[model samples]
Target: MSKLVNKSQCVVICCFPANYTVGLTTVVEALALGIPLICTKNVQMPMDIDHEHCGITVEPGDMGGWEKAVNYIAENPDVASDMGRRGRELAEKVYNLDNCAKDVSAVLKTLIKK
Candidate 1:
C-alpha cells in the first residue's frame, strides 16, 4: 500500500463506514510519492487529506462526488500536481512509517512498564 502510493501515478481512496475516522496514511503516502488523492468524508482523513487542497473529499457513496473528484483531478492538472506535492511533504513529516512505529513502540513500552 505504501509502496503503491509512493510510486503510483495517482490514487483515489474511497472509504466505507460513514462515521469512521479517516486515516491520512494513504493520502500522505500518495502525497509523498507525488501521487494525487481522492478521498471521502466517510472517515476523518489526516489533516492533509481533510483539506481540499491536498485532495478531494466526496460524500460517502455519492456518485456525484466521485465524478466530481475524478473530474477535478483530470481537468485541473496543476491543482492535482500541487496537491500531490503537498500530500507527499505532509506524509514525509507526519505519517512516515518510522513515526508510526515509534508511537506504537511507546504505547507498548508504557503498557509493559505498567
Candidate 2:
C-alpha cells in the first residue's frame, strides 16, 4: 500500500460497494501525498473525483477499465501532476479552517443577497 502510494505516478481507486465512503479518506490521503486519482464511477466516486480535470472515472467492472484509467493518467504526466497539485490545492481550499469559513461565508452572503 505504501509503495503504491509512494511510487505510483497515479493512484487508481476501485470502489463499488454500496455506501462505500471508506475510500474517500484514503483518496484524500493520496492527494495530500501528491498522487493523482483514477477512480471508478461506482459508489459515488465520479462525483467525488474532479472529472477529467483532477481525476478520470470509468465505468466499474469494465474489463481493462481500471487499466485504461491508470494508463490514461500515466500517459499524461503533466496533466496528472497538475491534477495532483490541484487536488492538494482543493483540499487546502475546502478543508482548511480559514478557507472553509470564507467559502461558507460567501455562500451564506449570497443566500442573503437574494
In the range 22-67, model 1's lDDT, one tens digit per residue, is 5555665566677777877754444636564677777778998899
Clashing pairs in 1: 22-43, 22-44, 31-87, 31-88, 32-88
Q: What TM-score does each of the candidates earn?
A: 0.77, 0.68
What's the residue-level lDDT of 39 in candidate 2? Answer: 70
Q: Give the clashing residue pairs of candidate 2, or none.
A: none
Error of 2 at 66 (Å): 1.6
- Cα lDDT of model 2 by residue, 1-114, tens digit: 687677778877776655556467667676667778777665644235755366776676865887777777878889888988887776665545586578789999999999
lDDT of each: 0.72, 0.71
Task: Give the TM-score (vs. native) of candidate 1.
Answer: 0.77
**Model 1 clashing-pair count:** 5
